[model samples]
Structure formats: C-alpha cells, structure tokens
Target: MSSDSRRFVSQLAHNEPVSQVFLASDKQLRPNRNGNLYLQVDLSDRSGSVNTRMWNATDNDYKAFDNGDYVHVEGATQLFQGNMQLIATRIRKARPDELDEGDFITLQSADIEKMRTRLTEILEQIQSTPLTRLAKGFLKDDAFMDKFCRAPAGMKNHHAYQGGLLEHVLSLMELVLAVAPKYPQLSQDKLLMGAFLHDAAKTDELFYDRDIGYTDAGQLLGHMVIGVSMLDEKVRQIVQQDGQPFPERLLIELKHLIISHHGEYEYGSPKLPMTLEAIVLHLLDNLDAKVASFSQLMADCPNSESNWTQYFSQIGRKLFKPEKED
Candidate 1:
C-alpha cells in the first residue's frame, strides 16, 4: 500500500518509534517460558515482510484481538533468540486498504496494447494452416485474449506479474523467429505456434490470488490437458462452420505439442515430444521460463546476488552472481 516502504524499512532498520502493519501470520498460540501467550505475524503488503509478535496472554491487545485480525501493532525491532522479530506492544487490524489495490501488487510496465500487437504479429507470421487458424481463433476471442494477455506466466517464479505469460511468449517468439531464418531444419511455423499456445489454457488453467494460485483445473487438468481440451472445442466449432479439414496429422502434432510441452510424463507431459517442432518448442519454452525467472530474481534481491539469488520457488536453484556496478 503506498505506505512509503523506504520509510517503513528505514524505521524498522533504525528501531525508531514503533511501526504499524497488517498481515499477521496464522500460527497456533503458544506460551513462552514467561507464561505469556505468544503470537507471531508474518507481516507483508507488497513492500516486504516483518515478523512481529504479541506478548502477554491477558493484555488488552490480546483480548481486543481474536489473534488473526490484521493488526496495526506498535513495535520496535528486536533480535529474538537469534532471528529478526518485532516486540509488539499494541495490536489491531488497521483500517481497510489505506492505499489503492494497484499499490499492493507487482505488475509489468510494458504497454498492454503493444504487447497485444506483438502477439498479433506472431499470429500473422504463422504459415501452418491448422496452427494459424487455432492461433487466430484464440487471438480473436475477446474474453480469452484479454485474460491471456494480462495473465502472468505463473503465479510466481518466472513471469509472475500481469502480462507475464505474454512476455514469456514474446521472448520465445523472438528466439523462434530468429532461429527460423538460420535453422531451416526446424519447422518454424509449428514451433512458434506451439510456443504461443503451449500455455494458452493457463489463462484459465493457473490460479492467481493477489498472485496466481492453482485453480482446481490447474491442479487437476493442468495447462497441458486443459489447453488441448480448449483447442479441440475451438477446432470443432471452426469445422462446423466452414466444413474444413484441419489436417488430422497436424492436429495430432499440435495436440502433442500441448501434451508434451512439459517434455516428460512425470514433469506433466502425457507423452514425450513426438514431432520435431514439439521437441524444439519444449526446450525453447523451458529455456525462456528459466532465464526469465533468474532475471527477476536478480532484479528482486540484488543484495543476495553475491553468493546465491533466491527467486520464486519454481526456479528450484538459487541464481548466483551479482552484476558489475557501473
């Protein structure tokens, strides 16, 4: 919330006149050696996090709060045993949304229209008949296009912010288009479409909270299965209207791209990449997702850049290495 992060962090760092915050952690109540009820809150609101605690089981602050309310606590920073913590004196949830929602979440600064235009450009460049039509059907759906373009590549890790998936797709397309002119052995058309549509149902597939969370569809069907189902429906509609044959073999291959984009069965693929384009698409998709995750990690935690960088979990390994300061 535009609660001046620099000031809040500075105050906490300096142990100045107590700080106030929302976002209390949901941990079970426990008694300290002093026999006071202790509650710790993992307080964060887009700026950063602070661990805060309420002491005394019978205090007015404890009785006044039911233990999980978003409390505005007056507290000074203290090192409890070893880790950083706040010794809270007062506690209560603050007034609702003192700042706008926009201030509370991370977002891409890219032009949405330009990104949409870029996505359109990729669609225009496709020459494969079935893939081209599938791409167009998706791009033309107003509701799906809006959500897909605005949706993050993930709920976390790589492109976790709004328009993240588009950014990922755009990045992969750049590589695909560049490689097209050089590597004629690969089917550029299918590769590009595969990359663009690989995560299409992610628009409906992945769950996003303040960030994206896994929906039931996401957890159960996943984007791989969901994307295939969605495209299959669209293909049926297109055939119904025009009575066109969308190349059965190519349709299967496109389905393969969706089903196998995860690259392996355990990784979520029902089948490994069967066609040439599917293989390249899987690798390229993975390459883009990883590089982007590392890039964001470096952006978020510059201090940790020296030894190892911590990113949103999907990256698995901590990205290590700091940039040279100019």
Candidate 2:
C-alpha cells in the first residue's frame, strides 16, 4: 500500500493527472441532455472527498463497482462551481492487494491516548460525589470507551473524522475547566459532565467502519434523545451496583443538560437551556463545533493564491484564509 508513489486525494491539483486508489461512494448514473449515459461518483480517501464523473461510461462500468468498493481511478482535476472536481477518464475496482484500508479512514491529528488521559484528569476534578460516580460509570465501561475513542462527532460537519467525538468532548472539557470559575453560579460538576456526555451517543449514531453514514437508530432517534436514555440507564446501573441512592434531582438535571444542549427547539432540542450549566454547555458545545467546522473549511480551501474560500452554505458565507507570516 505504501510504495512511496501513491498520491492521496488531498494532494490533487487542478489540471494534473490523478491516478490513485480510493473508496467509491454515492454512485449514480444519469444521462446528459443528449441522452448519453454518464457516471457520477464520489471518490474518497482519509484526507477528504472529491466528486467525479466519467463521460460516455456504460452501464457495465456502473455495475462493475459498488458504493463502498475500493477503486483505481485516473482523472484530471477541474474547477466545478469554483471548487475542485475530478473528471475521471478511467475507473476500475481495485484488487484486494492494491487496496489499503488505512487510506480510506479519516482520523484526528490529535494524540488519542493523551486526550484520553486528559479526559480522566478533568473528570477527577468533579467535586460532586454522585456526578463523579455517574461519570465513572461511563469511564469504566470498556465497550463504550472503545467505541467512544473511535467514533466521529459527525458524518460531514465539525469533527467528522475518526476519534472526533473524543477530541470534541476533550475540547469542551478544556474550555469548561477554563471558564467554569468565571461564572460562579454554574454547577462546575454538572457543566463538565454535560460537556462530556453531550455527544456521547454519537458512538452509536454514526457507522464509520468504511465511510461514515447514519445508523437506522440514528435516523429514527437522534443523539440528544438517545443520550438521555443512556444517562438514565447508567444511573440505574450505578444504583443497582452500589445499593446506594443516586440523587433523583441530580439525574433530572443531567438529563436536562443532554436534551437541551442543542440550545433551541428548531436545532432539535426538545427543551431550551433552562439551567445555568445547561446554557453554558450549549454555548461551549456550539463554540467547539463551529470552530472545528471553520478550521476544516479553511484548510480545505483549494486556492492557495487566494485568501477567500468558495462560499460555504453551512457557514452561509465565504471564509477568509489569511496568508501565513514567514
């Protein structure tokens, strides 16, 4: 897989020859105005994805590959809608020997082990006994930890890479630790716990083995609702294990934090942030996600000579990429 000759999807430049192995996705076939068949596909690697098309392709070519198949593509980069797109000339499914599984998974650049240790350190700072116990209930679950350490925060939006959920949570925790003191009325323990559990259900919401996609359960019930259920189940287990009463009021507040972290009803929260901790959790969570989204948008900007990226519908505006100072 590493011949020192492979070109990744991110390295593609305008009008250059591109020959590489990529995981194929979003396959569709349609005819031009002339009624000639053409293939439309998305080629992806760990770095990112690029939309591609093969003109004059036949149905056999379309049938030769599936959505998740690893394929070898020969194409040239072209500007489409002010962004880079690939105009493929040749495409074939890659043999098992040619496909490298590593090439297909996007990962966070942060050190996951260090992040995990930092998370543990932060959790230890929680002063409330019940909250501490509840947080530990999750930390002690090896099964959940394995998935949590690997799950992405989203499919395409902010922190949409392997280890993204952990990275995002850790980021929120760091911010809470820094700002919790400034606001004395906020419950320090609950605020930090909310940040950790806000997107914890994403471990199940997204299926990321090959490429990220929504699970049936995720489509049916979102992470916010699922997170409340998970928190309740954990509380029950804690009580059953210790034979001690877990505070019911504390549990309700924690559940509220998860359900209302989205901040508004339209954003999918069934309730708005009523508690100070919940309100703080919403703000910090949005801050981390929006910053991650903007950072990715800037990094993915194709034009090196230009400072402005193409208009992004998600951010609802084009971003300025300032030149680096030497």
lDDT by candidate, in order shown: 0.68, 0.86
True lDDT of residue 120, candidate 1: 92
TM-score of 2: 0.91
lDDT of 2 by residue, 165-229 (tens): 99999999999989999988888888999999989999988887666778888999989888988
Candidate 1 clash pair list:
70-93, 71-92, 71-93, 72-92, 153-165, 207-212, 207-213, 208-212, 208-213
Model 1: weakest 10-residue lDDT segment is 5-14
Instruction: Give the per-residue lDDT of model 1 (tens digit) for 1-326.
Output: 45544234313442445645454443345689877677655654444445677676444444565433455667777644323456677777667764344443445355767878987987898887777777777777898888887787875557765677887888888888877678778888888887888888888877444434677878887887888888789888778766877888887888888889889877868898878888888888889887876665554453432556544355445566756679
- After superposition, which runs of candidate 1 have C-alpha atoms over 4 Å from their true positions? 1-97, 108-110, 302-318
Winning candidate number (TM-score): 2
